[model samples]
Target chain A: MTDTLIVPTFDEPATEAAGRKLVIICSKGNLDMAYPGLILGAAALGEGIETHLFFTFWGLDMITTSRMENLKFTMLGNTAMHLTQAPKMPIPALMGSIPGMTGVATKMMRKQIADLEIPTVPEMLEQITQMGGHLWACRMSFDMMKLNEADLYEEVEAVISASDFMEISEGAQIIFI
Target chain B: MPTTMIAGRPIDVNDEGFLSSYDQWDEKLGAELAKLIGIDMTEAHWAPIRFLRSDYPARGETATLRRASTVGGFAIKDLFELFPGKPAKKMAYIAGLPKPKGCV
Candidate 1:
């Protein structure tokens, strides 16, 4: 499992063709945080690269059937998030804490994503799984959240431990998002 | 872009071997390109390839998997089996279209 092919360039020759592998550690559940891992994993799979997404910590919410579609985008503690009209000014953390602010932020983000015709979270999971990307739920997170297999997205492969992830991630490029 | 024979005549393709000129694509050349990538070019394979060919003109870019499934009416699961390892790139390559630009 430790043996993996050297990364191939864009113009990979047929004889030396060895499929690459990628593992993404999805550790956050925010709507903004969810996209980075899903996007990268799907991009890798599109290129014929083997891709695995491991959802741990709050990231387990990304795969939770009830939570995935409801992920919120709160600007609190996100220093980089700002309104388009005032890009120079970072929205105050206190402003992000106002009641119903998470809903507004999430709605705005969804509209922007939709304008570009991007798929929603559920759609992304479906497409990724269909394209042969592996989805895994961390056992520790699953237990912490008191979640069951039925509560998670159907595409999730299994609830596994950290050591199990290391085993499968051998020789694969790892991305923590 | 480099000029090279696909089916028989010369067509422009990029460094990664995607067809640069969208109009140069036809079924014969599509079959030939599929052969280069180890695909046998069945009707199932043609579904997505044909979709990409028709889709690229207005979109000006290759269609992503979701678009292929949604707009082209092709199932994502079937696409995986038909094109194997790299459906999006493989489909676009055979369709004589540029690489897909959509992240989703």
Candidate 2:
């Protein structure tokens, strides 16, 4: 019997008006952790993707106006923290526990980021929003933190429930951190 | 390193059709490239193109969206409307410059 082969071809380029959606769930408020979701969301927006960031728990600190600019950088419990000038040396985790260590770490980290001309967290949030990325605060965490709508960056859309987040993000690739 | 007839002249373009030779690009070619990508050219469109063309020699790299704003004075949101889906890549493509390397 003669057989016919059928092949399906998809000719669309991913960056060409494809309605790709990405939902990044941010649960960490640490200075370093904040960048991943924000940076990724920005990249996705630049690629014409619909990007949303849900800030919950400590992550709420990222969108909170009072704390966003002052997010802490602590090497506590992180054995990988080492000075760039001394990359071979390991920083003792206990060293992060020292009082004022986070301040030193934050200052150094900020300087490094500034050296690369990276924007501050607040500036990044503004940039992402201007690029059409959506930012949502977890309602429960928002209430638990005693945060009102006014406490959030003005660009934040709204505080939404987990179910609502899921509903809005259906068919989107979700990343939790 | 492939050559194709575009804008009524032989032009150098990469495999994805981004112009590879900077000197071969002019206003006419930029508009032609933009049309192929479904972009209707406007004066707003030409600003970033000119910026990228002039900025490339000094920087030696395509400007990211952020650089387009901070350095070139074109706001990010406005650039989005100008180039639509992918501003950095689209602007670079229409300008006959290399694609931007920075994420933002």
How displaced is residue B81 in candidate 2, in Å?
A: 1.3
Residue A118 CA error for candidate 1 (Å)? 1.5
lDDT of 2 by residue, A1-177 (tens): 112211111224544356568999999999999988988988888888889999999999999999999998998877778778999987888888899999999999999888877889999999999999998989999989888898999999989998999898998899998
TM-scores, one per candidate = 0.89, 0.91
- Give the alpha-carbon lDDT of every model: 0.82, 0.84
RMSD of each: 5.7, 5.5
Weakest ten-residue segment in model 2 chain B by summed lDDT: B7-16
Every candidate's TM-score, chain A alone: 0.88, 0.90
Report how far residue A4 has shifted in candidate 2, in Å. Answer: 30
What tens digits encode model 1's per-residue C-alpha lDDT throughout A17-102?
47467899999999999999988888877777888999999999999999999998888888888788888976678988999998
- Candidate 2, pairs of clashing residues: none
Q: Name the regions of candidate 2 deviating beyond 4 angstroms.
A: A1-17
